[model samples]
Target: MASSSSSSSLKFTVRRCQPQLVPPAIPTPREVKPLSDIDDQEALRTHLPVIQIYRKQASMAEKDPVQVIRQALSQTLVFYYPFAGRLREGPHRKLMVDCTGEGVMFIEADADVTLDQFGDSLQPPFPCFHELLYDVPGTQEITNAPLLLVQVTRLKCGGFILAIRLNHTMCDGPGFKQFMSAWAEMARGATKPSIAPVWRRELLMARDPPRITCNHREFEQVQDTLPSSDQNLVQRSFFFGPLDIAALRRLIPQHLQHCTTFDLITACLWRCRTKALQIEADEDVRMMCIVNGRGRFNPPLPVGYYGNAFAYPAAVTTAGKLCRNPFGYAVELINKVKGEMTEEYLQSVADLMVMKGRCLFTTARSYMVSHLARLNLKEVDFGWGDAVYGGGAKAGAGRFLGVSYFCSAKNGKGEEGIIFPICLPAEAMERFAQEFNLMLGNKSQPQTSSATFIMSTL
Candidate 1:
């Protein structure tokens, strides 16, 4: 069982696990190559930094807290060796810790508000951890340790929120979650963690190198330089109640002739988005769905194989054709793409990594982003509660936007269904909402779409 503290200034409980005996070292040989040797230009871009924020009441933890956190961070770094790697092409990663030198002013009644309230109050042009870094033009060119920003706030009610930003390259969501759990365990004075960290690379190797069957080049996007335009990218959140999801589930069977929830909802959104954006008939539009690869591989992977364990199954259709058909047609497209999501495909993907002589995996930036999002991101939790909102680290990037949807089993209404963070043209977002609401027979509240709502709560 875990021990919990209910301080007026802090509302989180710590789970304590028994320590494990030190086991004899198991030496597993693996080969690791430098990023330059990988022949992947885009791959290098995927290693950008991540920003993290931590909030807490001024007096709740310790006096001179920056030193305390720095001390803890020093110990935490030992367990995360991936961060220790040197940047072969650029400067080393930088890890910075700063205090909320100045206190924040909140409306008096705001103290009782939940996480959702704080999220809603953020203005449209608000600064997420990423935006703060983006404002600095030359920051992206550097490759160092993840930029960790810790903000300690003193809430009127005494409790606080700890926000953490991590670079996607350091670890995927599951990898980061495990790291946090380990950190929390260490903070609570646990001598050992229930699950020891493993960094074996052989387990992730493909049986054959260059297992190519299909040409993946079609999915690649070439860029001479990063886009300078910052216009039209906006972030917005949408709430889908249980009834709304149930209606979608029912409609799938009636229309697409399928019984699954994901297929049905995805189809409907695709239709609405195409209609709203008023995309040209001949334009190529795709909806990329993430497929978890943990249990799908042959001789199933261990429960602890925590690196990237996902694949993208994308469905592409002309904007005009998609809008002209019934929602069921879109559902079939989803099913077809999903059918290709198998261990063979993943192995073949790995084979391509071997065949390309490790260069494709390193130089392919678009491939890295497209594939990294397929990993399981919904499992992160930090003791304040199971994550009601979890998503990719950064947002607003390419032609194929990424969206992830998950239901809250820990801190949301039982009647709540699924909430998705999506990215589409501004106009398309509105159409998606309108058509989605029509499918649910709820026409009262008009939908507003802008940028991808990276964080979501049901």
Candidate 2:
């Protein structure tokens, strides 16, 4: 696999206009809004980078995507005004949104290349991502920084790429999807978003007296031994089409054939990854599955509540047991942990977060997977039809080790399937590919490659 910058041979320069602050079109109240316990977690303090590429469409050829989205963003901010505010920290590192309507950073640029030049597949890690979404200095801190940073780069072919640096402290993947869809609706000239934005952070607050009703092993402190240097790791995207999935399903027991796509893929990847890492036989390895808490509420959370509303329930086992057992073993462990996510479980997590002073999620020998396949990210359009690609700009969440995202995507050949970006050491990555190929019965070629690449190490 090639690095992000080296993946593409086409060289092009981007001429950028001065970045400006775009505030809400309408004035909002000057009040401070407290974030939910889940929103203020220590692990989510960094900004999440995302990208969307739009091709020139006949229907929208007459319009400028940058201008359209810029105007729409202002209008959308009226309903989702908190995005225009800056984050502030109180005593105990508690976070709050200072709703000053200060505005978000926006930039417009024109690239010399066209959409086709980016290669057949637009899935991440996208090449020249840093150029697409330049991180303006003094605007990336967790607090006292722009909540949203957007850069719209126009291509020579009239299509454009929309890149963003979103404050993870404000919302999770699903919540950000909602916000983007709403912004798209605005661009299409909707008077109001079909789903109104809601800000009831109090709903996910820790219970009174903060009781830890259930075990929260995902947050337990551990002596993390993962190497800090990214030079030892490489990022790559793997495609799982219908045939690939069917092949995996054959490994499971007949009774578990009805398992979900996420269940099957998570299990297969966990087994393959663990084997690739070659941890000690007795060492405990864990897989943390991010479960959305929206539906777990007795009465579901409001339709448009865009705060962090997810919990990571982990499945744990010894490396030897996980590797030696059949594939069904991993799936069962995943299914069991997923089943533990309930209303009570969410409350327990909130309590645990507060009790632990918002400690970071355990990273020791742990692989975290977040399923974005159901987030409806493909539906986000700024009047030029659905994007050619839209979602996380790269693999592995910002500085967090051993993180991966599963999303629905189309290949260069236009085949729709599940695509996941994995980052691992060069040696481990080669081993991972070999293990995966062995499962699929394709030993001829072990390594898988995609057009997108990660320029920066790790």
Best by lDDT: 2
lDDT of each residue in 1-458, candidate 1, tens digit only: 23332222323333212211111122222223232111122322343222222234344445333333334443444544343332333322211212111111111111232333333322121233332222222223324323232332223333333334343333445565566666555544454455676654355455643456654542444332323223444444444555665666665545455535666656766676556656567665667655666678677766544455555556777777777765667778877877777877765655555555433221111211132222333333222233333343333332223343432221133443344445544555566667667777882233222223433211
Model 2: CA > 4 A from native: 1-8, 225-229, 443-458
Error of 2 at 433 (Å): 1.2
Estimate the TM-score for candidate 1.
0.65
Q: Residue 431, candidate 2: how far off, in angstroms?
A: 1.0
lDDT of each: 0.42, 0.84
CA lDDT for candidate 1: 0.42
Q: In candidate 2, what are the lDDT values of residues 90-112, reduced to their tens digit?
A: 98788999999989999888888
